[model samples]
Target: MNCGCDEQRRVTVSRRRLLAAGAAGAFAGLAGSQLDTQLAFAADPAYSGDVLVLLSLRGGFDGLSAVVPAGDPAYYAARPTIAVPKAQLIGGGTFFGLHPALAPLLPYWTSGKLAAVHAVGQPAPNRSHFAAMEELERAAPGTSLRTGWLNRMAGSLGADDPFDAVAMGTARPARVLDGPAPYLGLTSIDAFTLTGDDAVKPVAATMAALYQGAPPALARTAGQLTGALARAKALRSAGYTPANGAAYPSTELGAALRDVARLIKTGAGLMTATVDSGDWDMHENLGPAQPGRRMHDQLAQLAAALAAFATDLGPDGLNRVTLVTISEFGRRVAQNGSGGLDHGYGNAMFVLGGGVRGGRVYGSWPGLTAAQLRDGDLAVTTDYRAVIGEILRARCRVGDLAPVFPGVTASSLGLVATR
Candidate 1:
């Protein structure tokens, strides 16, 4: 955590901050608005050590499907078409087999940066995508909760560069980061900065004033936008490319991750950054071919971006960082007539870092027999919040899990590689 980079001056005012003013901009049309005055700027901090990178694989991903349970005849019977064969997978095993499509991640699993949780999910079996995603994002295992868990986390992080929490990929905001920490929803790194040579003092003042009368989310958006604009200009001067020989897919997800790598390496005190990948809800033909099927490509790109990121940052970076990937829920065990799988419960969560208790799958594997499926889906043996709670407690040092996840007891899986 020795955070001294080449002398980058105390940030001056700039345009990126104007566009970035909305920490909650992702929810502009969605959820309730934030207070206007919460938009005040913060001074630079002495520490930016611990970082949490959250990747939400939207669409209920298949934990059983992703990490196949080939040993059990029930598994093959459950997924006749989509079930990955034993020999084709990363490693031959009795209980597990990564989709052959996910070969990119094999090295990490072997090197000990990746850890998977089988039969893992939220407490209640929420089938609706909106409901399940909302519960997960809120970090609330129960239905009766509002405000975001990450927001509460921001509340705990105290304050830094309002840029402490960022949603790096989508133009839309994420549910987990719904609380109060100023978070920017970034699609491109270029868009993350300012436009002109100098900081637009007049325009900044005008926009800041206009947003002054607006809601708090708007005001904060204006301020953070301005701050990012400033940093973007400086970052532009750096003109960086992938330094550690980490190759991100030449896809949109790749672009998103590359920016994240740049920000982390360059001393941007980003405490939480969220990235997303979707299309996992495969109700038909979730199979693998040369170019691979939709599931294959999706998993490939996902694993590629992740592997590249870990490589780009190198071993030292991985030591200080923990990357957690989650889905809304899991997919059904039984494949449909369309050759796809339906919505189910109990998926997996992958926690990666040099410190993770790697080389093993965490959580109790509820077998895929008739008795195991919760009303026809994988029965959840582990609560997702328990995993998040452990990270917040150990890595971030934020002990109170109640505010982040209300009503439910946080059962620590201890999957994190805490130094």
Candidate 2:
């Protein structure tokens, strides 16, 4: 049942470890009643930025499959068996066409809310998934800083609350949110609660009283837990139904996105959130562009969930939010004997939101001809950090990019409008 990738195997073990740690903190008993400083609440009312959602596509995602280069004859030559036929593509120009499985998102594409940036990746290629992912989250290359880019971004924006930077969906701590900034991790809104916290047991109240006269740090941590528990309780009590008749799929991505929308709509002072989706390591039988197949089904699920998220948010909510997708790396250009691709370099990124200048592909197209390929992989013309840096400045109102991505300049792709 494993993906046969070193990182995939490591991630499974890591998730287990994170789940144990998260459970002990999020579901604390009266004996050790501590929320582990993972939950805090301080909102910078002056802070104004789009609620950035970072979706990590774990395992090497084949960007060539999602954003097909139909106009490139070499693309078909590379993968004749798995290439998305040009006629079945949708919402693309002469050079690029989205995979047919992405039909759900075509409306957003056509309406200028969704866009893709091709040939984007790390500054230099590192094929090892673990190393690449670590570097990807760290983002500050050629520096000894261990802090994650999102944490730096949050710190730069004056984020002091646990709600400010959240790692939603599975209760695992996001590496991208690693640093001094306080953040929360939860599976969903309703599930975010202290263990045995009821009127009968009153664990939360007891914990609050226990830390009443404690020192500043201890008392502050206790207070944060109580406040966050109270807020989560209120949300659970009120309950939620997707707005605008938006029906999110029963999948993890759908639920995670739904909760993200809920947080935004309820004004949770959320600055950034991170979510992960795995199972993209297609080393065999990636399949053709047809329903029930691996690639097609995965893309369809992604499209459907994203479509639901946007529909639920509507225009006003989307205007204040932006979501971007990233992966450690992409797949090789040519299909293998098993009809799959191996690890690769350059990939594609999807940016979706109200401020986005969508309906077109962005980024320099390094032709797929053998001579243009970088070691049989797509050549990276756009740095992934630069793309995000641009979004941070233009849409998120981040005045300085040096703190988050040291030595990197924000891209001038005009991918999004400044707030």
The C-alpha lDDT values of all candidates are 0.67, 0.80
Expressed as tens digits, the lDDT of each residue in 1-419 for candidate 1 is: 21222211112224454345444443221111110001111234433435677777877887775677777888878766767767777744557877777788788888777888888888778889998888788765435667777667766666446453343222336666555556655555554433244354456446556777677757766666556555665777778788778888886567667877787777655666667766677777777433557777778788888889888888888776788888888888888889888888889888887678776678888787899778988888888877877877777666677777776565567777444
Clashes of 2: 1
After superposition, which runs of candidate 2 have C-alpha atoms over 4 Å from their true positions?
1-42, 162-172
TM-score of candidate 2 on Cα atoms, chains taken together: 0.90
Query: Which pairs clash in the backbone of model 2?
Result: 40-162
* Model 2 lDDT on a 0 to 1 scale: 0.80
lDDT of 1: 0.67
- Candidate 1 clashes: the total is 31
The ten-residue window of minimal lDDT in model 1 covers 29-38
The numbered model that scores best in TM-score is 2
lDDT of 2 at 241: 91
